[model samples]
Target chain A: MRTHHVTCDDDVKLLAALASNRDAGFEPLVGAYQRRVYGLALRLSASPQDAEEIAQDTFVRAYRALAGYGNDQIRALALRAWLYRIALNVFHNRVRVRRVPTSPLELDDGDGPAFRIEDGDPRTRPEQTLIASETERELAALIAALPPHLRVALVLRHVEGLGYAEIATLLDAPVGTVKAHVHRGAKLLRASLEAHNREEAKVEALL
Target chain B: MTTTNRTPRTPRTPRAPATPPDASLAEVRALLGRLRALADVDAPAALLSAVLGELGLDAADRYFSLRTPVGQIFVAFNDRGLSAVMRGESAADFERAAHALLGRAVHPATEPPARLVAALERSLRGEGKPVLRFDLRGLSEFEQAVLLKALEIPRGEVRPYAWIAREIGRPRAVRAVGTALAHNPIPIFIPCHRVVLSDGTLGRYSMGGDQIKRAILAAEGAAPDVLEELARAGIRYYGSDTTHIFCFPTCGHAHRISAAHIQHFASEAEARAAGYRPCNVCRPALGA
Candidate 1:
């Protein structure tokens, strides 16, 4: 999904009030963005519990650093990007805690509860349905198996739909490298799919 | 060489090195597609509430100067090994506050912490006011417009940033929208904390960063941890008597669902009249 700018004169005013200290200003900001942030948090963390913590942390961080946020440049950074960075950090730190290792299973399926195949907008056409169900499952498995950097790059580019430039800023990588990663990632996925299909056919023949 | 007409032939160029394996492309595509599918995933009420409460307390203490003092603090570490700190009040006070809040304390590195203290001092003095409000202040006209639309997102709700960007007539500015939010000013009220990375990651927050972000959502009445907390309290989505529904008013692209789509509706007519069924994904009616 694409992001649009929404700062208004009132936001500016509230921001001004916030510069010193203004709890009153916090509500409007909350009223404005609570859903967007929380929603994004849910998606990134893949766990309501984790997302909730990340969302609150994002705000507290923004509040504390309101002094150094540097006037709207953060605007150049999407709430998504900023929050993702925070979430990633949180996820990484959590990993350091020696929790039971998360399996390679994808959250939508293997890892967490598997989604009911019939779930989704049933009104969708058969063709779209087939593509969505089969291709999507196969693709997710392929992605889960990729290297972390490549996987993240693909997620940001295709899933997040971020621009190369924006991604460069977020990932701290050159645009050329980002492009290469995306292209290579796509190629690898295509190859894996072909290979998987072949294996499935071989197993079926034996059966 | 071309002028020699067929007399001089140039040697063929050697093929370039084989491209490296991306090994994850299909997975990435699937993951991306899954994000679109899960767009309707609702933010839990209990979780959001906790996060908002934490943020409310922090914001109240910081910008609002509410009854509380030193609401929150954010720390960052750069590649240069330089560390920065942004606290609500005095740098020293904020440091103490952090120690108190986190229940653990580490001595600040003399040089970096000192530099951070200096920056906070200048910020408190009002010299970097623009810098302080950069999240909203630095936005371009278009970005500002997009963010304004994003701000409309209600508590415990989410909409695609791309859709919002499209609503602003800048369909291609999806990334820009995320950027705008990253620099959001008056974060709690603007609720930039509510925004997420499109991949569904909670994304990053500059102030108090991630943990603080989580805390704020918890306070807002959203149930990010409803399941866990409920489990601890001996709760479950399937309760005794009444059937519950969790409706999400956001997601304009979503269809209007009625009772029939639900597994166990009150009655058949109630389900059909709505003309559409509730999604099984989030169970708008079930509150799952």
Candidate 2:
């Protein structure tokens, strides 16, 4: 999920076109929000394939909903918060049926992007890349394995940098409680990171 | 200090970055930053079209305006087949009406070209192969049956609402049959104008009233004056004196019957009493 800059004014333009003319500006809307929506799904689901499916479904549902809105109603929307809410619902609904448990292996593509960059760059230090990749992968896997409520809140808070207000709207929880849960989740994450680092020191002693 | 120090292995936290923006520890910030950066995957190049395909938007409902016997009209279709044909004041009006009816957007047709009009005109005149496929998707099963049966009326010929109702095996739905034909989305191509009142009068047409219906029928070689005359004379069925078969006045077999050999019956009972059976070709009603 590449960071996309779908400005509010741009969204208003797209919404105005879509509202006045059914389906107009839809492709561009998808273009603008696809990265953020896909990124949100990928983090929530921890699988690239499920992320793509969820992203596509989210946009499809958005299209159906936006078609019925008048210009002003559509223009007033905060697209990121709204789209993230839809993506969250799509992810949960899929999980309710598929019952896929989040395990460490699912985070293989969650953070470590070295496999793709290996062939693309020649100046890269393979040893340095390997160490960095291992660290990020371990951290991502830890985040992915968090309890659902904590994982979602923490990711929305720290990983995605969404404010508490938007996070509340997405998770449908009150702001104060969500902040506490995210802080508790962050503590658990730090403890896990420290424990994993201690294990690495023990392993290195043998080498 | 030297005796207490152990040889160092590879650094444990290779992910320490320039600065942790938040007050969170370096590893936590790095992990979240990487996740945020991965969002730049650009959503795979194929995803936009895949989303459109899922929303049923990739398959464009292509339409084009054309001039015909009835004047300018809109023809809309999709990969399924022709969905609508009607008159509109402008292309925008046509597009809006199509959206309201089909619940999807329509775009201008890029294919089908100028030759499409000629082929359809020939098909309507019974001179070309039956290449036109009517997309009657939104119609009910009964309405689809009614329209498809109406399609078999043979270009210049006419049938009654009751003929369609009976043909579709819903004899009591004669008025419903009229309603279906009246609301035929693809009018000229579906040829709803061919279905008239059982009394042989030109029925109301949703396209542009009876005058457009009469003109289109005239173009297809069904004479309006003859239909009017039959309506005035109260003739509901035409029979061949030699074949002893009765049909709707517009049936091809009845039209072929010579003036001297033609027989007109005011009612199906009269035709039955005269020993004439309903024509197998037109499949006229056996009961009242």
Candidate 3:
């Protein structure tokens, strides 16, 4: 998702206003975190409608919980980690109620090269722009198709640029486990992309 | 021999070779960066309002419109309950007045909550007694007392302003009672329409003109035509042959009397002279 970078200063201002029960603090807080929160939700749920509900619910729940906090409590809070935790909880609750499994990676069991390099860089050649766009789309699909637990760790680590310790804190897991999930998730993603490329080459040969 | 063996052991050690970085790992990192840059959609514009509404914050001091037989009635409310009910006023005018009265900004809701709509409908239909709560924040103690006394007037019945003033133990404040009714923030629910002039004429109402007031009274089984006829003819009292009780012309029982069995008296003295006692219901002896 398009990342709208939130500055540290903005978080400080938002937290201060929220601590004092000021209404003006609400808009800025929403603007600062909406994109990242929405992005994380969309990646988790893979449904725009579900993502919207989750995002709205996350902000609402945060607002209510913050309302009861004293100034000191709000000041000491880590807003991003707290918000992500809330969003994750909301997503898990929804998944539990729906009783549907997270989207699984569509790949056959096969061994392939760890990486493949095309002869020419697509961005350098306008003739290969369409192929490059297709590859990007495929990459997004592969990410979305990761198992829920691994996807969460991978997204937090790579997409959100979060460190393993931070992800462990957010997920309430041990740091070692978080690191392993990210590692295995990346390996599986690479394998699935390789398999997909092989199928595409086979189709081209037949054509 | 020991020195030669030590020298040979020292020469046998070699440094371990360094491993190179995987190009595949770099490609995967680049793909993740692209995914992070993908455009995500924003939440719906109404979502913030909806969230506030769900939390009961936006509704704290808001106006909601309801369709009624008279017209669209706008009722402003807060957490306490209904603050004001209005009609025919522009939204801006209503907002200004509500802000002055409630000391908070008032926004117009597309429609009121379902339970409120049902309560209003039942009140309008004059169905079973429905208890309605009100904010009445800006009203004075005397005004609140007058309005609360007016609530005692049953549906399909009208009372004189003096009756409300007397009921509130402020008999000399009859004009003040009128003023309070004129400023009633909640009209239909509190039922200011059930109050009339001492002369039995339907009084001016704040919600709409007197015509709307008359219609509301008629809907409640109070016959405006009969009351108007009696007022025009200067009839102060009516004697019912069935009950042998003379009552004020606006009395519910008095309105039922057939012309053949009806006797009109210009004054309570005339009715008493005719051997008719004052009806306990309307008490014509009290006189308007």
Candidate 4:
């Protein structure tokens, strides 16, 4: 369901193909969006097995739904956003049913010394290098720690490069709420990374 | 400035200025850029097959090509029935078309299942009734009707498209009947090629064009050369001078007559005017 920039011409072509030939047209649709959907599921579920099942379920559901859609509806559909919405719904339902606890983002109080890191001064900013030095696994773990709603909004905005309005439409929330969620999510991520960097530096100094 | 207390407090360091919003956002963007690598996760190739299986489609359908007398013909079928038969097409083309129609990729087998092999042989030899099942799931009602009627045209005999239309009670829908036959998915089983033009000429065919149509008809004991010769000579119906019966040139009973005893007529009126009755076997007057 992550939004990508599919062209209007492509949408028309795909819709036409689907309308006339569901089986042939569906292959290209799956080829186009499978990876992105799988990636979103993986990031959301944080389990490869669950991601695979979720991705498979998303396409099957989409195929069934599109089979009943009229030509005009298919032609006018925003495929990327529509798919993301379905995937997000599937992911959330699975989470609820399984009662799986997503990693939580924990923010220390501002009284922590890491909060004193200056914004404007370039000399005090080692957060970028610290993040760069971390492994991809660690970075994914950090992203996984965000709250579900914020993580979705943040990932859609940053990783997927979707606009606030598009994310709002997908999430069925107000644009203002989406913007606030993304902003707060980013703030928390930066603070958590900064605190981790400070702790690492302390350990290094002790050594 | 407030007056200093007795004991000078340790110089309080000014709190570091808050990180610039733009800088923090840039940091988040950088982190997200790293996460973008996860997008390359390839869903297993079997995922599509899995989905097709879940939908009860033909993902597990078996297919094989047999080199018959006419040409190389590809056939695909599932437990439900034989779904498709295409002539002179490559395996890839057959697979693609099958997938498009059935919503699943069919696997090509080195040898067809025993039952299918037997059915194909019987159908090719134009022998006894072959017991192969047909998967006509997506065909329109008219197409199914036309094809089902076409199946009644016995192995060695051919019927005109008009005959099919009239048989279906849509006598005026001859063109529509042709279109429906042309769209027939399972060709040999449906036998669309057996339907010809009203003038006893081999009409347009959906399989491998008219030539293959002629070949299949010939293999079924219909004389393609005789039909072509009669069409070329502007003969619509052939009348027997001795038997006093008019029959299609492609008819087996008519084919046995010598050219000396045969009287050719372009119109049914001309044949009837000459005191010839329609042959009960060929039924040429049905379309004439």
Candidate 5:
């Protein structure tokens, strides 16, 4: 059951625009996917600053690549998968060079909410809002702490709502391998959550 | 049978099957929903211009004459952000000047974006954090750093070019910082006017002149007259004798220091040696 997707409905229109002129079309293309690309980069690398650089470089590479492509080739591109592939590659190369990845997940103080915040309902209690935000932040930190391969696979599968075959294409891996990674990722995440809940249970008992 | 095509082939030899977490479709959906929410994030506003800045796309695509406290100035922008702010003789003159500066054609826009108009208006009032992004195409890294640091100067207070240099981690580039500020295309919004000379005097402004700079500063609530008097007296900082704190003469607290307890320092070391500490509000040491 695919649960999500990072898709653009105007990929065809955007491609037609780019096919005519890269300059005029690139801004709209960027506008459509900038947040999605930044989200993918942030997931792969747990730092927002790194995510921004990676997203910027990804578009630069994407722009140059599109410039060299034929108009037909440009129109045929699977926009979401193609852009995420570039962003993922950029994130990897950066990690290879920089080596040590320091993310806010390592320090609770440095990270604020990475999730979107809706204006709170007046009926909701302040403490409930606080608890929900805290939970979301903790859940995000747990996702960030996953191993790179599992993290990438799980994010693509669930966050992007992508099929295993589409993810396999993006990862350049076998469909079985991609599915295995997703399965392992989910199992590990569930176990970690259970462990965390038990620890909280002990703290609550003490209190 | 219908679901068989969607499932992947078994890649390895089957071992004892372990209980899979969230095997139920509904539970899996719930788990994935949490992942999606947690993974979603927003891009920063500066990212659009940052891309253009990286691509070196001098995007001075359109212009509109903005009515500002400093008078009418042509503001050029693209989808990224405000690219340039310049004063010229006329519409044709503005087009020619902006074109020469950007090395690109500048078209006249009928109305700037409402958000941009609002940002410009708020900037004139010397408000808090800036709301608009500057495209900053064709500027060197050193120059961009100088301009951005200048933006941090509170509207009414003044810092010397040396303060900008040190703030950007280029302590010896005071003269170069001056050059950068002078070349700043987005002047008033970036607030290059708030930076004065180390001797407490207003300096040359590339957009207009020193007179305009003083006028803008005075409008923002800085006592340009008092700053000039301090420069004439060779007093760069003022100290409260009772409070034992020293601050730049332009500091808001400096204006409140009663005359009887007022002491002055020509240099930071002089104040430090006189048993006075740098004011937390002005941060004399940081600026000096």
Candidate 6:
């Protein structure tokens, strides 16, 4: 495996090139941040295609705004926040155009297929794949059922592993409110997953 | 970094004859980790190229707003649109302003343009007459007052579903007010889209869903950004799998009620018979 290390100086160089209108500068920046930004968009949008579009838009918008950027400004603002903000705007626009009910499970564009975990892939050593698969499904469902705010908050907090203050800054809410959102959101996830497990067991018994 | 190198994976030992691979819990987590690795799948190359094609290098100062679903851009006017609609700006503040105007998630910078400002002014001045007025033509003594009251809602702003219920003196007739707004034929002139979910989401709009309503607002500079206008402002509680209720009342307090909380009365007389007074706050029937 190849190891890649990103120093702050590398970002500074990229920022300078991007500001100076050098197309090559975007390559390194895109490589370093695309996955993180795309992942954020997908979680927010709950659809891979929408996530991709939002991520692309985020970069385009970021590039356009790069000229006015300074090193101090870049250090102060997490690129993630700016990118996520752009992606969320794009997602909100989708929400409006499609008028998809605000529920996460209801994919507004029905053609965008649902993402499913592999159930029977043979590459894995078989020891406890079934148990893991079940758990994965449960986690996905729990995420889908959460209210939009709670789900986004939890994904940014735990899954992305951002600190509470960082999340509060990203969300533009008070730190206390951000903490509450994460705490309640996690509790709700645990309860929902537990309930789903119980219900699945009952259905299996019936079958 | 070598492009051909795959991410390192923990090597799995050959399975023991007696112990099947299915029995290994550690491997299950590893499988999940691999699936998670796929989470960063990039957008298709064609899509990326297309987006880049649209992005010109020197338009950094311009402001553009794209609609949801990712293909169409509604407004891409240069910085003039932003300045025409907002207060002041710093250099880097341009993107931030554009972002806010588009209503994505960022820190609250400025409240977008007030929804009702120009529309209310136009209505008060009686300019831009409705191309087609519905039953509101030759308004009755009582009806004229109600219609004028409904016009008070500015664009990108909202009043409660029940507020209109009380405004027309049909204090018990929230449903009747909805009917009146539903049939509001003059959208831009009457500005019926301003009425929203009591909790501030784009509720059921007579124009369409919240998006079209937002598009109209965006056109009017009523909201700075689409997300700011569309973001749900209040709490929603789901009573069951299929039933959800918005907890904020039209009157501003957070009140939880079920779908069945409001009885469906077939006619205005039937609603009156049920003794539910028109909510004094919203004046449901009054468009003003």
Question: How big a share of the true inter-chain contacts is recovered in candidate 2?
Answer: 0.44
- Residue lDDT tens for model 6, A95-176: 6686653444332223333324323234432667556545554455456467667767767766565676778777788766
Deviation in Å, model 6, residue B55 alpha carbon: 2.4
After TM-score superposition, the amount by which residue B218's alpha carbon in candidate 3 deviates from its true location, in angstroms, is: 32
Position B158, candidate 4: lDDT: 79
- TM per candidate: 0.36, 0.55, 0.46, 0.54, 0.49, 0.38
Instruction: Show the lowest summed lDDT stretch of 10 residues, model 5 chain B.
Output: B1-10
lDDT of 1 at A81: 59
Better by DockQ, candidate 4 or 3: 4
Give, for candidate 6 chain B, the lowest lDDT window spanning 10 residues.
B1-10
CAPRI grade, predicted model 1: incorrect
lDDT (Cα) of model 6: 0.49
DockQ for each model:
0.08, 0.18, 0.12, 0.18, 0.16, 0.06
Clashes of 6: 42
Cα deviation at A201, candidate 2, in Å, is 35
Full ranking by DockQ: 2, 4, 5, 3, 1, 6
lDDT of 1 by residue, B1-288 (tens): 010001124322222114345434465445446645533333344444455466544221221121212265444322222122343655566556544533334344334445544544453333443222222333479767865775566555444455466667777777887777665534554556665543233457756577665565565444445423433543222211122332233322232334353232232234434344543443333211
lDDT of 3 by residue, B1-288 (tens): 000001222222232111124434456457566755543334545556555666555546768777787887778876678888887547888888778766767887666678877878998898877667888756899999988888877787777888787678788899999999998888888889988877777879887798989888888888889877767887767898677799766677877899999998887778877888987776546543
| Model 6 spans with C-alpha error above 4 angstroms | A1-9, A67-77, A96-138, B1-51, B56-288
Q: Cα deviation in Å at residue A11, candidate 3?
A: 1.5
Off by over 4 Å in 1: A1-22, A27-49, A67-81, A95-101, A104-145, A188-207, B1-41, B56-288
The TM-scores of chain A alone, one per candidate, are 0.55, 0.79, 0.79, 0.75, 0.80, 0.71
- Model 5: lDDT of residue B239: 94
* Per-residue alpha-carbon lDDT of candidate 2 for residues A1-207, written as tens digits (9 for 90 to 100): 434577878878877766676665787788888877886776666656667899999998888888677778877877788888888888778767867564643212233431221121223336676565555555566666667677788778776777777898788887666766666666666666666667657655756
Model 5 TM: 0.49
- Model 3's TM-score against the true structure: 0.46
